[model samples]
Target: MTALADQTRWLDATAQAALVRSGEVKASELVEAAIERIERLDPGLGAVTLRYFDQARSAAADGSNGPLAGVPFLVKDLLTDVRGQACTDANVALKAQARPADADSPLVARFRAAGLVLAGRTASSEFGTTPTAESAAWGATRNPWNTALSSGGSSGGSAAAVAAGMVPAAHGTDAAGSIRIPASCCGLVGLKPSRSGARTAVESVMDLIVPSVLTRSVRDTALFLDIARGDEGPAPADGYLAEPGKDPGRLRIGLLDTRIDGSPVHPDCAQAARSAARLLESLGHHVDPGFPAALGDSTLDQLFAAFWSAGMGDLLADVARRLGRDVTASDVEPLNWALGTLAADLSADDRQAASEGVAGFARSVVSWWDDRDLLLTPTQAEPPLPSGTLASDPAEPMAPLLRSTQFAPFTPFVNFTGQPAISLPLHTDTAGLPIGVQLVAAPGREDLLLRVAAQLEAAAPWGERRPGL
Candidate 1:
């Protein structure tokens, strides 16, 4: 592979685009650099499961130009489909019967319009039901920070790819913290925009999943948001690029180190939040030790479990239809089988009750925003654990799943509330794994989150850090 430039592989998407736009580097050159990096590094990490290198090179050579012309990007393998690529959700059944998406999903279409060269698809959990990115089909995507550790799921492949310098930024989706969890585990910025302004082709289970990207810099995240927020125009026509680095005046920020479900947070994760709180205070924002009264209840967890199980059933049915065969327990992980089986037992009344419960919780949680401009919490309750921490067994599947996520009880609430939240890699633990801090904003107020995140990024810059390659 020809040398592109110093650290070309690590440059953010915005910088890569600038090089292409200025003709300092050809789009084809940038595309080759990414493909080269992926080829060189992906074997150790297993972040990318499918490659579209020839097509990407063809697109780059065509000069189909836009703001992000020639920037290399990967889509999470689950829901965000790219034309002529496998859209497996990391299930063996789907992987064995893979088919190219006939056309780009609307969000993928926007990425193409912005001039991103689609290079590959990243790994994700089966049906995106778990937080770790291991799959029977693609194996586990290892963290770049420490190879033995896992890259978090279901957006783990994208986060790991970006973290490993294979790409500047990659598409990720957040439903109950898929994007943010992996961002935390792999040390990248992951944003889940509010339902009002977020991009979507079709809503996933509970309509909680929001499409976004994982990047190394806040500016890259902002720019990608500008590109991904579809043409529907619920957001300002000017886009979100202007929000970062702009002064966000003193605002009310409620801090929650403790999870709402009364789950125990790792001390390192709690310290990460408290450290961010102090930093925000220094930056002139009022940080208080209070959260929504609606949080810390058992009902939210129960409701989420029910809704997720029902969604699993729906996903199984759809997968069966697509494969033209029944997806048996052996076709997927044990956890998925257990969840799908539970979903089969769900009555319509059970689904309705779960929906109602979530709606009620959302009302109470959103009401907290009336008293505060933002909510700050730990992105995950712990540092990146070794691979298979969230693995499942057919005999006792839920145990591992729930045990692995006790540190992340704060994220799912935001998903259910349909509010925007961003995970910033603001702190590190004793062993030096990245710990992300989540900042949540009211619905349709990503502008506020971006501004504050920019402030944090400046006050404690994380740009120079890199994983052990």
Candidate 2:
């Protein structure tokens, strides 16, 4: 590999930190390296939405005092508020409203305190209502694995940046599979912590939105979580970086190859799930092909849709009013427009029912995890699709793309249940695209999940495998 390629390609956050601490590499150097890669590759990929090079250099100079000192990373534009950088929700209506944040969002502050150099902001769908990364304001973020395919969204830009070797790791948020989907598409490790673990103290708009990180190795994810996790309570008996506890003692893993809503997984994806099962068995874990009792009901999907629509309505109303726009249906993407329309028709009773339904679903799902430590499933129903495949006019319908892509089925359950989940780049399709296998754990069990993930990573290291630049 070329020098830049060797340096930029998949150095886990831990490795990068060690290099920085050892004085082998300065934070500024890594930031400059990432900026150079972004400059060279992002033109064709369209992954980054904003650049903060000057600020990054300044931060890197002073960042050595923090835990993640000298490691460069990108924050997804959807939720993070970087001071003086544009926090546009990737919407044209919100473009001119970009203003310097008075303070970092709580999660952003934690990242900064960890000694991470903030390189820039990554792209996302407008309002983050869509699964693909194509935006009216920032254009499309193509998959780093395949320029013609999507990188996945609304954290697509972050995933693309990490997968393309622009950075060792980047911050991402997952309300409904945003982090994992893109990580799967680009062949990276993505972890969505339990809602509580990633909760932003300031942003209460969507409690379901869990902040996460996308990385090329499991250790990077675990280390990032160690730094990012809340320290409100007594420290764990052991730190998150503690080694895996001897093979998880033959896990009773529940494997669901089919979609949660009874939809069939793509043939390739099903095969991937089987492959993962074999791997688990090889590791001495008992894998049973069965659905969680909580997943038997389809009502959870409708309930989640109701909650999702409500969030979209709130965002549309707030952003449109703030921008002094008329807030017509045409101002948003098709999926968002449909959601907003549904929100308008929802009654107080409907809102109550949705909340109750979600709460009940959460309780039931948590109960399932109480029995089994891990839930294994396909990260997505199929492999990454081409750009514009999920795009539609704001006034158009949403059912086609929603069903065809099988979006949100497997992922939202964890978000709703406030459980930790991770997508591991374990399998690939016929076209050589990465297919991630997801592992979910009960609330506050990130340590266990990370250990299992690390074990898998050791067995099958995917970091060295990269798409041709």
Candidate 3:
């Protein structure tokens, strides 16, 4: 590889695209470089489950001349699809028998229209049931900072790939912090747009899932939201946002340095939020130790699981139908299989109650924004755990999901509430693992999130911090 290509691996998507637009680097060269990195690094990382190098090269040769044209992008092997690619979604059954998508999901189409080369599919949790990306199908996506640790999933593979400099940015779906958890672990920017954000039905937990990317910079994420948001998005026509610092003006920001259940967060994670709050206060924003009361409602967890399990069960049933057989313990991950059985047992009344409960909870969560401009919290309850920390046990299928409550409790509620939230790499654990401080804005207020996120990024630049291989 040329020295420039080596350097390009570390460049953010915006910079890489700029090089292509300036004629300093051919799109094909960028694709080839990424392919080489994937080949060299993915063997140990397991970040990529499939490679479509030839297709990416072809697109780079003659694809849309959109703003991000020529940047290599990987799609998570979940709901979103790249036509002709087998989106396994990190399931053994799907990996073995799923057919290729015939057409792109709207988000994928937007990605292509903006000139992003579809490089491959990244690993995800089986059906995106768990936060960690370890599965029997694709193994684990090792964190670039510490290979012995998980990269965080169901978007863990995409996060690992980007953090490893294998790709500038990669598509990831956030139903319950899949994008932000991995972004926090990998030291990238993970944004989950409003529920109406991208208009995709992937992992639709009451239509809670939203599509976004894990990028190295807040501006890249901002640019992506502009390009990929649905027409219904509050500002679908928003242009590239600039960080004027003072433009966003003083705002009311609350700091909740605890898990939503009123449980204490990890020392490092709590400190990260506190530190971010202090920084925001320094930047002329009002920061207080308060969060939405709705967030403290532990009953919402049951409500979410009631629907989440049903959705998982239905997905597994569909997979079985496609494969012409039942998906048993051997076929599905224990955690998801247990959840599937829970779904199978849910009755009409059960679903209706869950629906009502979620609606009420969302109203309460959203009401917090009526008075507060934003809520800042620790993205995860703790830092990245070691490999197999969240792996499911066949004898106890629900163990992993239950354990996730301690590992990742703060993100899922945002999905249920349909608010826009971003996880920024603001602090690192004593061991040097990245700690993410989350910022959430009201529905359709992604523009505000971006502006404030850019201010934080400028005040505490994290883009230059790279993990040692």
Candidate 4:
């Protein structure tokens, strides 16, 4: 790669697109630079699971002329689809029976329409059930900060790629901190927009998943939302680009440094949250150590588990119906099989109770916003765990998953509440791994999250930091 090409590593998608638009660089050059980065760095990172360098080059040479035209991008190998590419969702059976998407998914189409060149697909946890991307089908995605540790999953590969400078940004989805967790682990900015942020039925199908992006800069994320948000409904008036750092008048920000269920928060994670609260207060926002009453409900864990298992069961049942056979234990990973089996054991009444529980949880959490504009908490209960720490133990399959829930106790409630949340790489542990502090806003209030995230980014800039690898 040329010296100029190497320089692309430091630029955001917005700047890369500017180069293309200004005729200073060809889109093909940009694509080739990213392809080179992936080829050189991904062996150790294990981020990109599928490559489409030739197609990406072709698209860059003659793709749509939109805001992000010529910028290389990656899609997670999960919910989002790229035309004619196999999306395995990190499942071995799906990988074996891979089928190319007939067309781009709505989100992918928006990505293309906004001029993003779909370069490749990144690794994901099986069906996005786990928070760490160490699927048996693709092996583990190692953290760029420290290879011995995990790249937080289901969106781990995308986060790793972005962190390692393979690409400026990549697409990700968050059901329960899938995007934010990996972003936290990999030292990037991950934003899980409100359920209504992107008007697509794909998310409504599961009613939990929300498509988003992980980027190095807050502005890049804002630019993505500007380009990708739905055109139909009530959308942000002026869009998110440059909206960051704009004066977001003093606001009520509630601070909750501890896990709602009273699980022990790692010292580093607690310190990150405290640091973020102090930063917010210095920025003139009112901060208080308070949280929602609903978080204290012990049934919250059961409610999320039942819904998650049922969702997995729904997925497997659909797969079976399409394949004309049942998905047996041998067909999936131990954890997935266990979850599916548990889902099978749930009665209709059980599902109904779970649904009601989720509804009540959402109502209770929403009331917290009635008094506070934003909520601050640790992104994860702890920093990145070792790569194999959450691997499915054949001797005790469910234990790994339960441990994952505890690791990310603060993130899932936002999924149920359908609110906007962001994980910012605002602190580093003694070992130097990034620690993320989460900030959440009520539904349809992503603008607030972006504004505050920009303020934090300016107060403590992290864009220059890169992994040693």
Candidate 5:
């Protein structure tokens, strides 16, 4: 790679855009640098699954118009539909299928409209069913910080690429903590925008999955949101990027260090949370140990599990039918098989109860947020696990796999509530693994979250620290 590429590779998207816009560097030069990094690093990381170098190069040469004029980005393999891109969702059953999409998905279109270059698609778990990025088709995605440890999933591939400087930012989706978990593990800023911020068409059969970006800096994420949340009509009262740096002004920040389901948080993870609380207090924000009253009910866990299982079952069945094959336990991961079985047993009344319960829980949580500006917690209950720890052999029983993966208790609740949350790289353990602190806000209050996150970033800068890479 050229010296220009080397310097620009680690720069945040906003900085890179500024460089390009000022003609200090060309977009093609940046794209070439990104492609070089992907070629050199992705062999060992296995983060990138598909390449669009030719397309990206052509678009960069064409000189697209927008704010992010030459920034290279990757899409998570799960939700995006890039033209001529083969999306496997990292499942072996669908490996043979590669088709052209007629047009960019709304989110992709927005990225293109912003002049961001789409480099390729990143790896993900089968149908994004698992939290770890161990795919039956692709090998495990190793953390850039330490290859032996995991890069959390199903957005693991995107997180790894961004952390390794292969791309400035990449897209990720959170169905059940997919985005935040990986971002925390890889030491990137990950925000799961509210379901309303999602650009894809909603499917009635499944629970809502919010799509978002993972970036090295808060401003890049804010910029991407500004572009992605296009003029679908009039902007929200708190417009995108309207006041990202505006002072939140002595906010009441609730700190929840304990797990919601009565499980214990790992020591290192707890310390990270405490450190974040202290930082907030030092910044003149009121930080107190508090719990969300709505999450105190154990029944919510049962409902969340049922809804997630049901949604997975529906997606798997649809994929199987589309491929002209009979869906069977042997064809999928063990946890998915167990989920399918549970889904089959769920009656309409059971599903209705789950939906109503989750909705009520969301209302309660949002009501509490009206009193507090943000809720701070650990992004995961523990640090990143050793690679393959969350992996399940198709031959094994599924119950153990599910229990083993629940070490991450802090991320799924926001998905369940459809609230906006961010995972910030605030602390690192003695072993040098990054531990993320989560900042959650009320629904549609992403602007507030971003401003506070920028303040926190200034308070504790993480940009200079790079994973071993």
Candidate 6:
């Protein structure tokens, strides 16, 4: 165990792939070690919701061929589907049905094409409706740094698994900040790529969601973007792996160290952003106290709620169709149940108006990037919250949903604007919990985010900072 740990436990996926390519280690050895690690560590973290160990073992027989070949991987139990796996999206009803996916989603197919061994599924909140990965179906995913704290959701399980060295990288989806928030909590690099060049994740009113992976290093994220994007859209064919190793060139970066409403930020969270701003300056980028003013407009919240609630209603409709019966309030988590109810009450015209309003706001906010290359902010409103901070009973079904606003105010707007953002784990709060500082790039500029993130990573060196778990 000690020798295997030394050989593979903390190596990033890129490093592991290099080993396989060099014939220094077989892909099967990597998969077996990852399986052992997950079995040893995941009980306390509640990260992986299902296991496909035998399948992964068989797949690894040829996983030694190329880049990322046979690397152990887990997909978040969200929208991305792997053929033959049951995608519950962290809901009990679907888990009870245990229906397997007939075909892989495009992104999952790309993951396989990259030679990633599909290990299993990680937990997410029901329909990805919450930040904390606490669902009645799968329970909570704990932070590897501190068991009592949450690994931010709905990508908590993926983030947790990566941080705990269960896997070098794992798939996660970000609608708002699911990728970034959990990456912060678990001290991993999570990138939510721009929607334009990435595969379209169509939700109800807007295509707000983007799929990404939570990884321990920026190069892995970049390499993944190269594979995941796969000659799609305006992105360069294959420079993602090389982008991070080169200098990002001096550029203007705007800083917003407060909540979107101009309210005071948590002192620790603010300091994390401030420190990152200084770090950026030291690295040759111009940093100023500037951000898009549209971020503060209250109506943005209303529009986002409308879009998200309508998406929830759509989720229920799909679930109902799957079950061949109407999905009742009791079928889902409380907050999402309430959201679907509100969505059921909204008129189509209301959704249309909300979409148009959000588009206007996106134009206004994206225009800020006309002069600036990036916007810097705290990845989360505060450090990772305690285990039950967002939990609520059915009597107060909307409580968790309401609390989510205060918890992740700085991140969701990036989704609404359809831009690319990356969260880099740079600082720790008083509790020794990881605090990620976000860097946002204009839409279709995930390459910029990766370059800057790589620059920061080189300067700060977060790769060796593993949790004690």
- Local accuracy by lDDT, each model: 0.85, 0.78, 0.85, 0.86, 0.82, 0.86
Tens-place lDDT digits, model 2, residues 178-265: 8888888899999988876432221223878888888888767767777776475332224665644435567889899987656688
Q: In model 1, what lDDT does residue 9 have?
A: 77
Taking all chains together, each candidate's TM-score versus the true structure is 0.96, 0.93, 0.95, 0.96, 0.94, 0.96
Model 1 alpha-carbon miss at residue 280, Å: 0.6
What local lDDT score does residue 195 receive in model 1, on the 0 to 100 scale? 82
Expressed as tens digits, the lDDT of each residue in 139-187 for candidate 3 is: 8889999999999988999999999999999989998899999999999
Error of 4 at 209 (Å): 0.4
- Encode model 4's per-residue lDDT on 283-332: one tens digit a residue: 89999988899888876777667888888889888767645688888778
- Model 4 TM-score is 0.96
| Model 5: worst 10 consecutive residues (lDDT sum) | 197-206
Runs of candidate 4 with Cα error greater than 4 angstroms are 197-205, 233-237
Better of 3 and 4 by lDDT: 4
Clash pairs, candidate 4, are none
| lDDT minimum window of 10 residues, candidate 1 | 197-206
Quote the lDDT for 115 in model 6: 86
On a 0 to 100 scale, what is the lDDT of residue 190 in model 5?
94
Each candidate's clash count = 2, 1, 1, 0, 0, 1
Candidate 1 Cα misplacement greater than 4 A, ranges: 197-206, 234-237, 261-264
lDDT, model 1? 0.85
What's the distance in Å from true for residue 393, model 3? 0.8
Model 6: per-residue lDDT, tens digit, 81-101?
A: 789988987888888988899
lDDT, candidate 5, 1-469, per-residue tens: 6687578778988888888899998999989999999998999899998899999999899987688898998998875777667677776666655555677789888888888999999988777877778777787999999998889988999999999999999999887788899999999999988877332233233457778899999888877777777885333234565555788789998998878755679988889899999998998999997768987786676877777767877878886875688876656767777777888888888877777777777777678887888999999888888898877665664643465446677777677677889999999999788999999988778878888888889999999989866
The sequence of per-residue lDDT tens digits that candidate 1 reaches over residues 368-400 is 888789999999877887898777776787876
